[model samples]
Target: MAMPVSDPGRTRVVVTGLGAVSPLGPDLVSTWEAVQSTRPCVEPIPEAWEAFWKPKSRFWAPLPKEWIQCPLLAPLEPKQLDPVSILALESARQACSGGAPAGRGGVFVGTGSGGGASRFENHLNHLFPQKEFLPGRRGGRFNPFCIAMGMPNSPAAMISIKLSIEGPCRTFSSSCASGTVAIGQAAQAIRSGEVEWAVAGGAEYLVDPDGTQFHGFDVASTLTRIPTREECNRPFDAGRSGFLFAAGGAAMLRLESERSARERGAAILATLDGVAENCDAYSPMAPAPTGERIQQCALEALADAGLLATDVDCINAHGTGTEANDRIEAAMLERVFGRGPKVTTTKALTGHLIGAGGALEAVFCVQGLLDQIVPGMPNLVDPIADLDFVLRTQASEHRNVLKLSFGFGGHNVALVFTKAGTP
Candidate 1:
């Protein structure tokens, strides 16, 4: 069933702020520089994790520990909150900091690793007391607030509590596409007159002290088996092996109605032109070989924005670096735009953030428009498709950007963004 969307004539939504905690750096500025440089953040998987099991993949893109210790970010003690909630709370803090709390604001956040920290810690400890199943930690005790912290909605609720958002608060759990869906839903609410502004994005910290996530993905043969960290991160390349699994991180965008932002004298960064989401019932973990649904999603998003295929100048593709995914997505983009738009894959730099990947890419899309450049991919040695991949940072006056994200469970979401000051 279709949800009721707002009349485009009534309200228009725009982005006013952006925040992120990424493997490349702690804040948006530092990370953007690293991103522009095409720096790969993968590292040798620490030997400490070997106590549990040996893995097929040798490198991991773990979130920087220093970022978590940054002051005055999280709403509560960092230890009390799971890494997922902490990442979300910190990004939300940064996004909602300067402005006065939005009395009628809503909170929409997404997370795929809500089960990583508190969930495992509490449950494993209860089942086996004094057993050091997880490295650097003993599983002998449990906390009273374990249940609350482990809840998937904890990240969204924490943001609402910290920022005093008084409207509908929701946590989207669409796996890798979670962040994109959250931001899209928030934009819909504003356009529909349900909220004045909303904090929307996603965070993930799947690295457990015990190595649960590593073993699972590695064993499934979906992680990069390349020997060197530098060689392992490749997107849209003929030799692309698999995605670089990041430890965790978060990214958030503060979206407001155009009128509210103008009245408050807020600096508008980008116009949220349109958004659309759908599911591919074809598979639970793989996109259909026909590639019909993914293509339809992109076209639908443009229609929602009242735009045509020729209007878009760039594409922020959900390039996971996996052979199957890259081939499928390339086919879809080619069939739709036919090598017209500059397709950029950011996973080469940030790795596969899973839940947080989409939100971070959205932030990059806004940043790219502001800088008037598209990020390059030096790691992709051979072209996998005919699409125009930005091989190096190139200056451009491109306005409209399409950000696409597809999750494992066939969740497909597309969002269209226009440069600020565009009619």
Candidate 2:
């Protein structure tokens, strides 16, 4: 379908509500608190997982069991649904819980590795007859919902059904940049007058007990074996090795047109002023060495928002704790915003959420705008570059902020945000 024209000033997009289920915590408040305190959310691989796959990276970030006590998720049948879909549903519930006014909106979700984990393992067990690995059902009869639950678009479809969203429900799969792209597209949908609101974000449940799944990254030599949280992942730090795998998580935002929000007296969280996406076309899994395309993405996004780089007070970086990624990202920020806006990466806290990385970082950016404080990087011991790193939580009167996300296959995305009603 052709998108409606996004004529600036005619249809403005604003975020009214936010929700998340992360390794640090289940909901937004807990996640924010954990971020502020620089708490390490990564943990040693669970014993249950140890019985199956022996990941090169022995540490992972899994959601606390207590945080899953969401009333909205109680009705879900875990046997029939994928954990990715469940996480998305719960996050969307919390985001729309504020009773914000909405219209015939839609659901947009971003995920890098979509489903098929447990099902694939079960199928393999049936073929291999393994006693230790995934135990297949006696009849070889998989759950009826396996296909539906594993599709990349499953989360979006589920949210649309549960929320009665009859608009254009869609899913975006751009590797790790999936969630950020979904959010950017959803905001465009509202700005183009296609919907009054959109429930959009990203989620991922890639880590599983299946070695078949973890082996790919393991062989790629990207997996780091930092078993202890204190020693594990450090974003943009000189001592950084690589990102530790993180838990399946989701973050949903209630995005609405400014006109629709005011008409319904919705409490505005922040304005999603602009979004831009581009590709490096350099390599499938590596970023462009020059960092030129990534810089262009940020510049275009700021221009779309009718703002200058100086207007951006803070930036939520896509710091993956890998040597190449941190180096390129640090250089990109230095080139784009100079030694100006405060910079920090949430991966040090939440590990790498993959598809949800951008969306979750966006959550932090919105909250930073509202709270007027920049959250600090947890394990950033020595700066990789001369950029202004937010070493500790500090108060600021920031009005505009930028969220950056990059994915494998050379996808890069940037979103610009401002305090609601910023003139």
Most lDDT-accurate candidate: 1
Backbone clash count for every predicted candidate, in the order shown: 0, 0
lDDT of 1 by residue, 15-133 (tens): 99898999988888888988778776988887877877878889888887778753555445776777787788778877776785343799999888774677876787788777765
Residue-wise lDDT of candidate 2 within 1-423, one digit each (tens)? 122323455688899989999998988899989887878687777656555556677777888786544454445566666788878877888888867465768788999877746567446545655343344422344566777767888888878877677899999999889999999999989987888899999988765555455566656756665566677888888887778778778998989999899999989999998799999999988889999998889888888888888878888888888778889989888877788888988887888888988898898889888889888876787897889898777787898899999999999999998998785
Each candidate's root-mean-square deviation in Å? 3.0, 3.8
- Alpha-carbon shift of residue 43 in model 2 (angstroms): 0.6
Query: lDDT of each prediction vs. the true structure?
Result: 0.85, 0.81
What candidate 1 gets wrong by more than 4 Å, as runs, is 1-10, 73-76, 101-103, 132-137
Candidate 2 total steric clashes: 0
TM-score of 1: 0.95
lDDT score at residue 217, model 2, on the 0-100 scale: 68
Tell me the TM-score of each prediction against the true structure: 0.95, 0.92
